[model samples]
Structures are given as C-alpha cells and as structure tokens.
Target: MEHDYYKEYYELERNHWWFVAREGILSNYIHRLIEQGKLSSKDLKILNVGCGPGRSSEYLSKFGKVTSIEYDEFCCEFASKKTGLEIINGSITELPFEDNSFDLVCAFDVVEHVEDDQLAVKELKRVTKKGAFVLITVPAFMDLWSHHDVINHHFKRYKIKEVNLLFDTINDGNKVFDTYFNSLLFLPIYFFRKVSNFLKLGQKRKGSGSDFEAFKPGVLNRILYKIMYFESSVINRKIRFPFGVSILYNWKKF
Candidate 1:
C-alpha cells in the first residue's frame, strides 16, 4: 500500500507556497548552471533521479530533453501527466538506464531516504556521460533530526565531510564542483525544532493541514522567495555556509 502521508504531502506540495519557493530556488541554481555554460538547450539530456511528481523536470525541460526517474509508481504516473515526459520507475541503487547516457543527472532532496546512499551515488555516477554534471540536494545535519525525519523514513541527514567520504570511492576522474547548504531562513528554525524533538516536547509529524497557511500569507512568501533567490545566486558562485536546512552539491565525471 502507498504511504498515505507521503502521497498527501506530495499532493499538497503540487501547489503549496513552500513548494513554489523551492522551485524558485532551483530556478536560480539552474540559471547559474546556464551562466557557467553547463546547461544547454541544444545538447543536454537531463535526468532527474527520484523526481517527485515531475515539477523539476518541467522546470528543467526548458533547457534540455528531460527524463525523470521516480521509484513510486504513483509519482511516476503523476509526473508523466504533469510534465509530459518519460518517467522510469526504479530504485536509485539500480537506475534503469545505459551507462554514460545523460549530460546532467539531478537528485533533489533524495539521498537521506536511501539506506545505502553510497551505492546510490555510485549508480548515479554510472549513468552519466564523461564530465557530465551530477547535481544533488539533501537534508543537512543529522543533529537536526525531527518528527518529520522519522515519518519520512530518513536514515540520516548529511554532514559535508560525510557526503564527501561517500564520493571518495567514486572514479578518480569524477570531480566535485561544489557543495554547500541551502534554506538559510530555516536554519535557526530547524535547530529549535530539532531541539524540541530531542527533548520529546510534543513531537509529532504535523499533518497535511498543519502549515497549510504557513505560506498562504502571500506577502511573506514573496519576500522570502526574493531573499532566497539572492541567497541562492550568491551560494552558486561559491559554496560556503556555517549551517543550513539542506545541502546542494555539484559533481562531474572526468
């Protein structure tokens, strides 16, 4: 049976303010990739690993041919309907594709849920072309664990050094372009949330209705989006963060 909570959250994400804000952040990141000449509409074949409901693929398709791979059959179906792109259903440990077939492979906010993140990274490396970009975003800091992490089945959040270690065994030719944290606003909030959870202070996964209006106040949402856009641009130029809610990384095969 499908996890009802996951499904409901995804449906909410389809039109949620938090979701739109995240998309804007991604757009800024993609723009930077374009500015660096890493993404091109004419030649790049983009793959979005663990693509949820295909929103990222739809955004990325403007730059290249996009194919999204999702493990959930429902997500894949929804993604196909939403983006009109091909959706492959499979595990990250075993990507259903030929080696060196894509120019860009992206997995956003996905690695933490995998039991074997190292194998998952290796699988991603195997499917990309030489010097192809591998972009990933994952929750940062295991210390920030909360009820959300428990409900989401997250094995562990990442530390920069820990993630770097996972890439150590990857082909020597593969180079890390950048690694940095994202969601600056949520840093302190997450710290407190984690602390609260750690203390067992009324810890519970907020149901779908909770936070439904967190972003509904459009003024706040728009302002936050603009701030994040600026922050994202700055970070893309150079990855540096004392801490954050999530991490974004860029790597390329040699």
Candidate 2:
C-alpha cells in the first residue's frame, strides 16, 4: 500500500463498514469449515501472512494460536503491540517457516501488492499442511483500478479466473473450495472509481489523507454494513455471487 496508508488502515479497519463486513465474512468462512469437521480448533496452528497491524488477531484468536507475518517492520511493531500476538517481520515471497507448518493460512488483500504473486502463493502453499485451508481476498477488476491502486502501489488487481488459476497451480491441483465476488456495495464503488479515474482525482497521489476525503456519514455507514452483513450471510450459505468489487476464496491444499 501507499507509505502512510497503515495509519489510514488502522483507522478505517477499526470503524469502516467495508473492513467490518469483510472480516465478518472471513470469520464466517473459518467457523463454517470448523463446523464441517474440515478444521479442528484443538489442532489449529494459523499463519496470517501479510497480517497488517494484526487488526484481525482478535477474531483469528477464536480458532487457535495465531502467528502474524508482515513484510514491513513498522507494521510488525504496530501489530505486535496492538494484538500482543507473535509477529514476524518477513516477506511473503520467502516465508521463514518449515513445510506444512500451518493448519490454516490466510492472506487478506496482500498479493496485489506483491511483485511476484505466483512465488508468494507457492510460498503460502509450502507452509501449509495438506488439506489445510487458505483464505484470501484481493481487489477485483482492472477497471476498478484508479488512484486507490496507484496510491497503494498495487502490482495488479485480479479477476476471478486469474486468481483461481494462480491458486490452483500452487495448491497441488486442488480447486478452490469456495470462491465468491464480495463487496455487495460494488455498484456504488465502481461508479466512484470510474468518476475518480475519469476526472483524474487523486491521480497525482498525495499523502495518507487522500483515501479519507470521501468518507461517509455514520448512518450511511451502518446501512452499508447491514447490506453487506446480509450478503455475507448469503455467501455463508455457499451461494456464489456473480460479481463484486473484490474476490474472496477458500482453497484446500492437496
């Protein structure tokens, strides 16, 4: 992401509906797997790759022990202090863990920022045990590419087919167990991105505050959160959404 976006992330993730809903959805997915006997909390050893500031550790802690790995030292420091969890400052391209070390590995919105996404996925697979689950989320569609991607220094956004292919190759031929287009708020966000790109808004890329210039009101925020909550419920039921501003998936290691 952009240099100072961590501060923005810290704030937004704490209060933003987008972050809240996404985390809820991911939590639902994890617990669902647990319910199906696919994952056992007693034997769980989780690796949160690229876990920024460890904002997710609270929910993740419900499953089992959590180990956070971040490429940035600043983020590691912040996350460690905030979450009080084990935080490793390291790169995802080369995870400093043994083969099949983790029962679950989750990478949230991290791959798009990686230069070698394929290598990163391979590293993720290398660290996860056979039949373990890997949950991930990434920005979707090149058309949604705008100052957000630019400010965040994203290497690229992904389509459903593209991300699926990337994971399939690294997952030992195992297909993604469940994949869905997320962000039920996609239409509004799409239009916002289109307008921003068309008008060259924030194209020059300033500092950290550019992202919050358009923050919504409290009531609207709650309303959007509710909508996403319902959509996430739909996803929890295994109904794959056709499109969204982002993609979320769970893959089982073969």
Candidate 3:
C-alpha cells in the first residue's frame, strides 16, 4: 500500500483530541530544545520531513527559515495555507532538496509509516549538516497494535533499542543524543486499547485511528494539557518509563 494513504487517513483526523495531544507534546519538546540552546533563531534553514499541517514548522520558523516536505498533497496544501511556510509535496525517500542543506531535520510521527524506515533515516542524515540534529517521534510497542495502527498504515510500533539500532545502521557519522517516550498520562489509554483488542472486547482495530478530539476545550481538557506539559518537563529527566504512547529521539551527526 502506498504510504500516502496514511496521510489521507490522518488528514481526516486533524482536529481530533489525539491530534491536540500530539501538538501539545511537540510544542513542549520544541520549547525545551529552544530553551536549552540546541536551536537558535540565528541558525537558518530547516527541513521538516512528513511535516503534516506544518504545525511544528510554524514553531520552528521562529528560529529561522523552514522548508517542510510532506507526502500528502492535501496536507501540503493545508499546511501551506495554515502555516504560510515553504512546503513541498513529496516523500522522505525522494526529498527535493540538495545534500547537507539544512541545519535541523525533523520527522515527527512519520517514520512508522515508511516501508523501509532505516533507508528513510539514511536520507534524513544525508541532507542534514554535520553536527546538526534530526528529531523524530513514532508510536511505540508493537503489541499495543489497535485500530490506530491499522488506520495509520503503521508497519509496526518501535522499541527504543530497535529504533536505536536502525538509526545506528543508517546514521553514518550521526549519534543518537537522547531517546524517550511522550504522553505518559495517556499510556493507560493505549494499554486499555491493547488489552481490549487482546481480549476481543471489540472488533479488530485497523489503521491510524484515534478517538482523541483536539478543540474540545473544557476544564478537564485544560487540566490534561497541563499535566502533559508538566510530564514533558519531568520525563526522561526525573522519570524513566519503559513504554508509552509515543517515542521521541534526537540524533546528531558527528
């Protein structure tokens, strides 16, 4: 199946709660990276692979120029209109830019859908400047397979060590700086979904399906968002979890 189908699948889910939760987590991570001086406005030129709706690119643009590439044409149009950034319609394996052109490259929630994730990582490394970073996030735990995986066209969720190994194989001179999971509070939600599937409580789930609603702001919603923000601060620092809804990795070329 062409992975572009996965893009269309998620385009329908842009406003769901799952999407909101994802954005919140990404915002928190970027804020930390910016604060830590890992990124700066003085540095220009960034490449955002699988830059759905350009949400992260919008934030990244503040630091410099951002060029986002996405496989889904609909997503590219939506993101171009929404973020007003330079976005190209293309896949990660066939990036439109020249080599060693970007200061930072990001592929958020994108790798799992690729048929050969390691080859895609190699492409990411090829385009990034030496000493620059490639940031990525993907679903974790293959056993947590549910409707979301089927709908999203995820080949499989990742194990940190497995992903590390893949990155190592394709990294060339790059080294993984850190790796951790996100959405700790929502781990239970994933657990429930997985257990429900295992027990056959519902029909077999398929695709990148999520029940999360994004703009349904309420007191509980606000609280949950705050909790996630707090978690981002303490996670991978004070707390180390073996599993969660998503995994984040930051890799740097040496």
> Which candidate has the highest lDDT of all?
2
lDDT score of residue 34 within candidate 1 = 82
lDDT of model 1 at position 211: 32
Among the numbered candidates, top TM-score falls to: 2
Residue 110, model 1: lDDT of 81
Q: Give one digit per residue, the lDDT tens place, for model 2 in 146-241.
A: 877777678998888988778877327475555555457788888987888788777554655344446654997888777876776787688888
- The reply for model 2, stretches above 4 Å from the true place, is 170-173, 203-213
State the lDDT of candidate 3 residue by residue for 99-212, as single tens digits.
888888889888898998888888888898877778888888776787656655678898888778877884356554445554556566666776766765444324323434
Cα-based lDDT for every prediction: 0.72, 0.79, 0.69
TM-score, per-candidate, Cα-based: 0.85, 0.92, 0.80
**Winner of 1 and 2 under lDDT:** 2
Cα RMSD (Å) between model 1 and the true structure? 3.0
CA lDDT for candidate 2: 0.79
Residue-level lDDT of model 1, residues 1-254, one tens digit each, is: 14455566555556565566567667777777788776664767988898876777778777788888888887777657755778889989999899999988889878888999999999888898987778888887776776666656689998777777777784545555545544667765576666767665533435532333335546776665566556666676675666676777778788
Clashing pairs in 2: none
